[model samples]
Target: METVIITGGTGLVGTALTNQLLERGYKVIILTRQPEKGTNKAVSYARWDIEQQTLDISALQQADYIVHLAGANVGDKRWTTARKQEIIDSRTKSSELIFKALQTNPNKVKKVISASATGYYGITKDHPFTETDPPADDYLGTTSVAWEKSIAQVISLDKKLVIFRTGMVLSKDGGALKEFYKPLRFGFATILGSGDQYISWIHIQDLVRLYFNAIVNDRLEGIYNAVAPNPVTHKELVLAMAHAAKGRSYVTSYVPAFALKLALGEMSIEVLKSVNASSRKIQDTGFQFSYPTVQEAMEQLFK
Candidate 1:
């Protein structure tokens, strides 16, 4: 059986992707800072220290493929100077560790798949951004550029590489959806800013499937936007989500940009940013999205 080693395999995307890989009969090794014995026979955990820049070399030698998803949650905290550094370091450092391990070790790793964010396109854009667009000169863009660059070094090692620029991942379990669902319990459909900002999103299941597709489909190289076909405005998304949850019982309320800025500080820029990214490139590869629209995704998640 083919073996795939994943960094940050305990996160939402990683956990979902792990189940997918295991169900398909692939051996899964999760590289974690804290190694633990897994209950599943097909799953195991290895040690990787980003601080010391160390990795379990034995894991690298056994991996047929590598999926790099280790990174700090950018929205998890206020973006203080130190927090911003942590965000960049978490992604780039982990990537550096993976690349270094693969470089020094004699391994059979054929392809490497890494996750990047749609923030590479910048905070807001009117037109749909493609993979060819230049990385914006902002914090998010620069962070993504550096993170991808760290992983891109694997190409020099003659290993195939695939990088996915992901958008907002909507999952019923946790993530953006859970936060969106928060106000709904009290019958409030809280809309952020003007609520017209476009939200490029993909279902958690679909996102995991995209990773699986890259693993099996060799044609997928370079970068592709991991978003649903149809992007929705923030207002439309909240209304649909509210409809799914409480029919028409929820009250639609707008949260001013200033309020969000005050509450979130600098991180509010991302919460209010309108990023319309295209999935055309991935779709052209004959890859279909199981949940191509927000409405459909909401129905599935709420049903």
Candidate 2:
């Protein structure tokens, strides 16, 4: 059986992807700082330390493909100067560790697929940012540029690389979806900022399937934006969620941009930034989205 090595395998996206890979009959090896044994015979864990710059050599040799997902949560904490550095380092350094391992070790790994953010395109007003668009000059943009650059080195090792500049992923288990539901519990549909910023989002199922397709489809090389075809504004998204959760029996409240800035600090820039990214490139590959609209995605999740 072909083996796939995944970094950040315990995360929201990583956990879902692992289950999908196993369903496809692929042996899965997750690289973590603290490795442990799992009950599944096809699933195992290996050790990798970013600070030490080390990975299990045996695991690397066994990998037919490597999915890079290791990184700190951008929205989890206040973006302090130190925390911002940690956020950038977790992605760049972890990728560098993988590249170094592939460079110094003898591995037959064929392809390397990694996760990126729609922030790569920075803040776009109405125009849908495409794959060919230049990386933004802002914090998220520069950080994404550095993150991609670290993994781009693997291309020199003759490994095929595919990076997905993903947007907000809406999942039922956990993520922005859970947080969005919080206000609904109080019967308030809260809108952030002017509620005009566009939010590019994809359902968890489609996002995981995109990664799986990248692993199996050789035609999907280079960067592709992972988002739904029809982008919605922040207002449209929250209202839709409110409708999904409580029909039309909910109060609408707008959270001013100033309040968000005071609360989220530097991170609020991301929450308020309007990023209307396109998925046409990936769609051109003939991949169909199961949940193409916000209503469709919300219906399934809320059901």
Candidate 3:
């Protein structure tokens, strides 16, 4: 069995991906800040501090693949000046650390798959974004652009590099969907701005499958939008969640743009803006989505 080294293995996506990899017979090693916390028999943990640039060199010795998912939570707090720096530094420094580790011990890993986000596109009106679409001009966009660029350094090592430009991931356990529904359970849902802003989302299961596909398929390189084929508006998504919860809930009113701006600052655009992403790149790579529509996905989660 091949060995895969994963960073941020305790996160929502990382936890799911680690289980899937282990189930499929891959030996998993996770780069964690707390090595003692990783008790799973299938997983071995290594300690690394990106800020200090310290890593256990042995961790990369037999890594067949490296899945980079380490980063500070974006929506966990308001994007203050320090918080913004934390987000950017966490991503860039972690990637740089990984790349440096690879450089120190060349040919240890076969491929490096790093995490990017749909925030790369920032706030767009209605233009459907593709891999070729230029990144938007916003704080999130700058953060994502810098995040991806930091990982691009690994390409010089001649290893296969795949970047997943993920969208809003819908899952019952955690992520934006659960938070979005928590408010609806009180019998009302608030739409941000016009609520017509398109939200490109992918089921957690599908996103993990995409990662596996990229790992096994050698042809999968460069960037791919990890989003559903049918993107829905903010209103449509909130309504679907309310329906799934079977709550007597309705979108009462729009949260004005100014209010969001005042509340979230630079992060407000992430919630108030729209970007319909095209998934043709991944589809053309021969990956079939298990859940294509928001209704089907929500049904599975809610049922």
Best model per lDDT: 2
Model 1, C-alpha of 285: deviation from truth (Å):
0.4
Q: Write down the RMSD of all candidates, one decimal each.
A: 1.2, 1.3, 1.5
Clashing pairs in 3: none
**Mind giving the per-residue lDDT tens digits that candidate 3 earns over 1-303?**
898999998899999999999899999999998898887877999999999998888878878999999999999999889999999999999999998888887556878999999999856565689999889878888899999999999999988899999999999889898788776766777678889889999999999999998889988899999999999999998888778777554546567989989988877878877889989989998899999999989888988
Q: lDDT ranking from best to worst?
A: 2, 1, 3
Query: Over 4 Å off in model 3, which ranges?
Result: 247-253
lDDT, residue 193, candidate 2: 93
What lDDT would each prediction earn against the true structure?
A: 0.91, 0.92, 0.89
> How many backbone clashes does every candidate have?
0, 0, 0
Residues 199-250, candidate 1: write the lDDT tens digits.
Answer: 9999999999999999999878989999999999999998989998789898
What would the TM-scores of all predictions be?
Answer: 0.97, 0.97, 0.96
lDDT digits (tens) for residues 96-212 of candidate 2:
999999999999999999999999987785579999999899888999999999999999999999999998999878888788889889999989999999999999999999999
